[model samples]
Target: MTPKLELRGVAKAFGEKGSPTRVTAVRDLSFTVAAGELVAVVGPSGCGKSTILNMVSGLYGPSEGAVLIDGAEVKGPRSEVGFMLQKDLLLPWRTVIENVEFGLETRKLPKAERRRIARAELRRIRLEEFADSYPYQLSGGMRQRVALARTLAISPELVLLDEPFSALDAQTKLVLQKSFSRTLSESGLSCLLITHDLQEAVIMSDRVVVLSGRPGTVVDTFAVDLPHRDDPLARSTLPATQAYVKRLFDTLHIAEGAA
Candidate 1:
C-alpha cells in the first residue's frame, strides 16, 4: 500500500535571497508513515522541530524537494491534514461546541450534519458535558481536549500534533497523553507528533525520529519494541523500555548540553 504521508529531500532555509544566512532546518528529510500509523519526532529545544511540522503542514514551503500526501504532491493546505499546535488556540468567545463546529463552518458543512459529527467527536474525548462551556471556564487539560475534538471535527486523515501536552503539569500531562494516545489509536489516524519528551515519544509512537540541532536533520530512528507500551503501568516497569529511553538520552545527549 502507498504510504499515507511522504517527504523527499525536504529542506528549508530562512533569511533573504542574496547573501542569505542559510539555516537548514531540515536537510534531506525523508520518511513515510503508513495509513493508521503513529510516528513521533523528538529533538532538543530550538532544533527546528516545529519548523519541520510547519513544512509538513504546508504552512511553510520547503526550499527544496517535495511533500506528498497519499501519492499527491502537497501544493497547499489539504483538508485531510489536521494540525494541533502547542496552544489549544480555542476561541474564548465561542462555546465548546461552537469551537468544535468552527472547522465545519469553514469547510461549509451543513449545520445539522456538523453538529452531529462534532457531538460525536466531543463524546469521544469525554468532553460532551462541556459542550456549552466557554474555553476560559475550562481547565488547561479540558481546553486541550476541546482542541483535539476540534481537530477531529474536520475528520482529517493525518493529524500533526505539536507538543500538545507540553504546558500541563506532570500529572495532567500524563493523563492527557494517555487519553490522546487512546483516542488516536482508536481512530486509526496517521499522526506525526513533535515533542521534547523522549518517554512520551516512546510511549505514544510506533517509531521515533531523532533530529540534530540548528541545521536539523534526521540523525537516527528507533522503533519502540516494548511490551505493553500502550499500558501506562507496563511502560515504566519494562527493562527494554528503560534501556531504549537511556539510549535515546545518550544519543541526544540532552543531559550533556546537546540542545
Candidate 2:
C-alpha cells in the first residue's frame, strides 16, 4: 500500500554551511505513514519534532533526502494536507461558522456553498449551536474543535497535528481526544500527530514513532495493537494498551537519556 507520507534519509540544519554555530536539528530520519493510518510522533522537547513537521508541510525544505506523499515528491505544501497547531488560532473577530469556513473562503468557494459545508462540519464537531458565536465565546476545547472543523472543511487527505491538545485541561483534552478518534475513523483521513503524552499516543494512533533528542532521529517505531477507539477506559485498563504505553515510556526514557 502506498504510504500517506514518506521521509527518506531526511536531514535538516539551521544556519549557513560555513557557520560553525550552525545547528543540526534532524539527521537521516526516515519513516513512512501508511494511507489512512493515524501515526503519533513523540520525543523530548526541542528534539526537532516540529522541524520534521515543517519540512513535511513545506514551510522548510529538507537539507538532504526527500519527502513524498504516495509516490510523488512533496515539493511544497500540498492542498491535500491540513495542519493544526497547538493554538487553535481562530480569529476572534470571526463567528464560529465563519471561522470554520475561513479556509473555504480563502479558496474562493462560493459564500452560500461555503456556509453549507461549514455548517455540516460544525455539526460534526458538535458546535453547530455556536455557529454565530464569536471565538471568544467558546471554551478552549470548543475552540480547538472549531479549529479542527475548519481544517476538515477543506477535506484534506492528511492532517498534521502538532501537540494539538497539550494546552487543554485534562477533562477537555480527554473529550476532544475521543471526538478526534471517531472523526478520523469515520472520515478515513490519515494523520501525523506530534505529541508528548505516551498514553495519548497509544490510544489514538495505529502506530507510534519515537524520536531521540536534539539532532532528532527516529529511534523506534511500534504498532499500537490495542483497540483504536479513543476511550479513556480502554487506554487505562486494557492490558494490551497499558503494556504498549509502558513499553513506549521505557523506550522514550532510554532515548532521552542517550541524548
Candidate 3:
C-alpha cells in the first residue's frame, strides 16, 4: 500500500542557485509515514526539521526530489493536511468554538453545520464548557487544546506537528501529551511530528527518525515497541521507553559530533 506521506530523497536550499550565499538546509533526506502511523523526527538545531514540514505542507517546494501524499505529488497547499505549531496561534477575538470553526468557515460550511462540528470537537477536548471563552480566558494548556480542536475540525488525513507542546510547563506538557496522543490514536490520523524532546518522540510516536546536522538527512529510524501508546504518561515511566530515549540521545549526539 502507498504511504500516507512520503519524502523521496528530498532536499531544500535557500538563496539563488550557484550564489555564494546559498545554503542547503536539508539534502538527500527520505522518509515515509504510513496511514494511521505517527512518526517523530528528532535532530539537533538547524537540521531543517521545520524545513521538511514546510515542504510536506506545500508551503515550500523541495529544491530536489519530491513530496508526495497518497501517491500524488504535492505541488501546493493541500486540504488533506493540517499543521500545528508550538504557539496556539488562536484568534484573540474569536470565542473557543469560533476559533475551532475557523477552518470550516473558510471551506464555506454553513453556520449551523460548522458550529455543530466545532462543538463536537471542543467536547472531545473537554473544553465544551469554555465554548464561549476567548483565547485569553484559557490557560496555556487549554489554549493548545483549543488549537488542537481547530486542527481536527477539518478532519485532515495527515497532521504535521512542529513542537506543539514545547511551550507548556512540565506537568501541563505531560497531560497534554497523553491527551493529544489518545486523540490522535483514536482519530487514526497520520502524523509527522518534529520535536527536540527525545522522550516526547519515544512516547508519542510509532517510530522515531533521527536526522544529521545541517543539510539534514535521515541518520536512523527506530520503531517504538512500548505499550499504552495513547497513554503517554504511562509509556514515559517504562524502562523500555527510557531505553528508546537513550538510543535517540546517542544518535543525536553522534550526528552533532560528526557535524
RMSD per model, one decimal: 1.9, 1.2, 0.8
* TM-score, predicted candidate 1 vs. hidden true structure: 0.94
Cα deviation in Å at residue 192, candidate 1? 0.2
Q: Give the poorly placed runs of model 1, Cα more than 4 Å off.
A: 254-259
Of 1 and 3, the candidate ranking higher by TM-score: 3
lDDT tens readout by residue for model 3, 1-259: 9999999999999999999999999999999999999999999999999999999999989999999999899999998899999999999999999999998877867899999999999999999999998899899999999999999999999999999999999999999999999999999999999999998999999999999999799999978998987999888889888889989888888888899
| lDDT score, candidate 1, position 93 | 97
Reference-based TM-score of each model: 0.94, 0.97, 0.98
- Top lDDT model: 3
Error of 3 at 29 (Å): 0.7
Q: Which candidate comes out best when scored by TM-score?
A: 3
Tens-place lDDT per residue, model 2, 1-259, is: 7788999999999999979989999999999899889999998888899998898888878999999888688888888889999999999998999899888876867799999999999999888999999998889999999999999999999999999999999999988998988888789998999999999888889999999999999999988877745564456677788788888889989988887
Error of 1 at 185 (Å): 0.4
Which clashing pairs does model 1 show? none
Question: Which residue pairs does candidate 2 place in steric collision?
Answer: none
Better of 1 and 2 by TM-score: 2
The CA lDDT at 19 in model 1 is: 54
Q: What's the lDDT for candidate 3?
A: 0.94
lDDT of 3 at 247: 93
Ranking by TM-score: 3, 2, 1
Report the Cα lDDT for candidate 1.
Answer: 0.85
